[model samples]
Target: MRHACFLTVGPARFRIGSDWRAPIDQLRALYSDYPMDEVVPDFTVRLQATSALRRFVRPQVAIAGDFTLPDAVPLPLHHGLLAAEMAMNLQMALGWRRHLLLHASAVSRQGRAVVMTGVSGAGKSTLSALLAERGWRFLGDEFVLLDPETGNIAPFPRPISLKNAAVAAMEHEIDDDSRFGPVLRDTPKGTIRHLRPRTEWIEQMARETRPGLLLFPRFGFPRAVRRMDEAESFVRLTQASTNYVALGERGFDALTGFVRSVPACAIDYATGDEGAELVERLWSETGAGAGDRAAAA
Candidate 1:
């Protein structure tokens, strides 16, 4: 059996298996991995993935391979890189609660979670990167978890993926060479990197926050920011969500609850700087405040 360890983005426990190890030695060596101060034990999630294709079916958790790659053909590391994410989505879809699977980039600040759902070219990654750089807690660039019961969002803490022009922007912004991993060549999207979030935040990987805002970010001319109605937001979000149709009535209830509770907006910006400022203003507007909210149910 192959052995590897990962820190997932939900509430569960410290899981163990013949194929994995915990208290990640490399992560510990690089930086002190400590739990968040306001630790919520109940929200913690720990699980293992034994199947490759099945692992890529979810949102939050990811997997790492121990086997050596041949020099001739580059392995599909990114697909494998997101195994945990796939697992998270699968777990949520099958779990008891009804959640609308949204295709969005999500993050947290103060105490609230914000999801930015958009199509492939809609600057979701760029916006997410901007938020992460501007002190917002990174939830995910590709997936966001929403709790059906309280209309709150859960953390899907994983690496921030940057592609094409976004990569250049990040390279220009950060000084540290170690902050990024080796650039992979020829992905369907483009060349990419697994961006490392602040070590302090990574230590708090087990932490989950509530859903406070939903935004459909668009990049184009006449740059401006506008608030979207909850009803319209719900429609768009439902479409972007991964397993909305699969979850049925329970999923609809969860989505409606989320739309009602969280403020939804449409962010229009051409540049990352403007996008970052818009998010900052939104964060301040929301009552994220100082302390963390209770973890999702």
Candidate 2:
């Protein structure tokens, strides 16, 4: 806990303390666009050595914070940056109660947001990152914050964690080298790197957008789109949400209202390009309908 840094992403502020300075330095450089001023943090994460001897020997970083998994394995010192990121995610997943936390990625355009969620490797993260590079404003690449009372989407705008093929794909899409973090190979989810979102999106993190569309995207498949019903979308989202049951009735009301309000679809695409195209087409159709429905209501 000798080295520490404060980070504010959207509605959450985090204080990450590390046993070594390397992780803190990495965080500072990557999150340079974010608000790092000293403030009361919503959550705290600690990166400590696995053992007293490990601090001097082959140092290993263990995730310790307000909420932690007892069976979590420690990462080597070289992967301390990833460990810090993971620790922050753990804290948000278990501790955050201000909003309904959906394990999804989101993007906004014309003041309306699209929420995408699916299993890991489902291409939601990649799709959101790709759209961010395009005309869409990146809201978040991890958790989509849904205000329980208003049912609006709060932007998280954390760095997008690109894994395996995604890392290279984004590198090809974005020419700027300064926006990417160091590559950490052979991690839990394979080779991983962080892509810093556009500075404008980071600066606009506090702005919230109305939900326009809900997508469940699956990658590496032939292109297809299926309309999803409210009941099914509700059940799926309950599974996708990290703190749904923890929030109890408030979570249920928020989620039900969300599914009922937005148009839901399950999209499958073989490549990132196709995925982006699918989203664009659907938004044109569904987004217009959302506008009409809002007017009618």
Candidate 3:
């Protein structure tokens, strides 16, 4: 805990303490656009050595904080930044309650948000990142915050965690090298890198958009789109949410209302371009600019 940094992403604030300065430095650089006023943090993350001796010799950064997983493994000191990012995600997944949290990626256009959820390799992250660069505003790539009462999308524009092929794909799409964090090789998810969201998006993180379209995207598949019924969408979203069960009645009401209000689809694409194009087509068909739910219905 020798070095520390504070960050505010959307409505949540985080205080990250590290045994080494490298990870803290990386976070500060990557999140330079975000507010760092030392306000009270919603969650605290610690990147400490696994043991006393481990601090100096073969240092491994253990992710410990307000909430932690029992079987979480420590990362080598070089991958401390990834460890910090993972820890922050862990905190939100386990601790956050003000909003229903979905394990999804989101982007907004014309004041309406598109929430995309899928399995890890489903390319939701890449598709969202691609859309953000093209024209849409990046909401988040990890957790998509859903306001239970208002049924709005809260923007959590943290840096996009690009893994393996995604790192190269995003690198090809984005020209700014400085917007990227250090390339951490051979992590649990393979060679990983972080891409900071555009400054405009970060500055506008406080804004919330109405959910317009819900998507379940699957990568490496033949191009196709299937309309998803409310029942299937509701069931899938419950499984997608991290704090749904914890919120009980509030969660149930919020989720049911969301599925009823927003139109959902399952899209399969073989490439990022196809996925992006498909989303655009779907968005246009949904009449997101008009904020009309009936169009999808």
Candidate 4:
């Protein structure tokens, strides 16, 4: 049997048969126009589509050993495909030994990249949109992959996911022409919007950037900017990182190395203007202003 489904996150390919009783062939019979690829032996998954219940007479069929979620809803939907795509992207990002994946937003200016690491409510997306509007190149809004070997950051360049007040904050920062696409209303995270990527940087979306500074930004009162010591910064960063649980010992080593090698700080502010100024000051102090390369070791 043949079946075809495409995902947006990574490589757009799929094959629906081989390990399971020729399901792909059955699919091909129904939809001759759909494309098909021979399923690889290693790619195993169980079949649990609602439609399968009528054909197999079993509640679920184990496809290639991976258990598919039981189908109470519908069959042949894109949920599995979507999950696979996300997994693939996650795998690809983690595959690089040179990179330690952090949950953050990254932006580049004058060839230097600054990564902002924080939790969901930590103003990362807001700061990222603010920086992009001010002519800084947007690397990514959620994931910052820092190369351990070269100390450079690579761009994942996914859509900038913003929530609630951030939407208004971004609207105020950018003109209508520069606004990213449209605002998505009433998302799970509360009225979300995805800022479209800058087209000029699309080709270089996967390019690596040298780590100039690591920032932990927060939105709060009594705003203050302070440079943190390496140890303190490392502690805070470890807490803020996303994939640290998966990285384990290797993650620890990479995080420690990064803190020691680069300048890290915490910026507390209530507005984008202060955040932008703090970032600008960091770049200037590091000697990475326009037309200037960061000072060499």
For residue 147, what is the lDDT in candidate 2?
Answer: 96
RMSD, candidate 3, Å? 2.5
Superior candidate under TM-score, 1 versus 3: 3
lDDT of 2 by residue, 51-146 (tens): 999987999999999999999999999999999999999999999999999999999887899899999999999999999999899999899999
After superposing candidate 1 on the true structure, give the runs of residues whose Cα lies further than 4 Å from its correct spot.
1-7, 11-99, 285-297
RMSD to truth, every model: 8.4, 2.5, 2.5, 8.1
- Model 4 alpha-carbon drift over 4 Å, by segment: 1-98, 176-182, 287-297
Superposed model 3: Cα runs more than 4 Å off: 289-297
On a 0 to 1 TM-score scale, where does candidate 4 land against the true structure?
Answer: 0.67
- List TM-scores for all candidates, in order: 0.69, 0.97, 0.97, 0.67
State the RMSD for candidate 2. Answer: 2.5
C-alpha lDDT of candidate 4 relative to the true structure: 0.60
Of 1 and 4, the candidate ahead on TM-score is 1
Ranking by lDDT: 2, 3, 1, 4
Pairs of residues clashing in candidate 3: none
Judged by TM-score relative to the true structure, which candidate is superior, 2 or 4? 2
How well does candidate 3 match the true structure in TM-score terms? 0.97
**Per-residue lDDT of 1-297 in model 3, one digit per residue for the tens?**
699999999999999999999999989998999999898899999999999999999999999999999999999999999999999999999999999999999998878999999888899999999999998999999999999999998999899998899999999999999989999999999999999999999999999999999999999999999999999999998999999999999999889989998889999999999999999999888756464454436
Local error of candidate 4 at 189, Å?
1.4
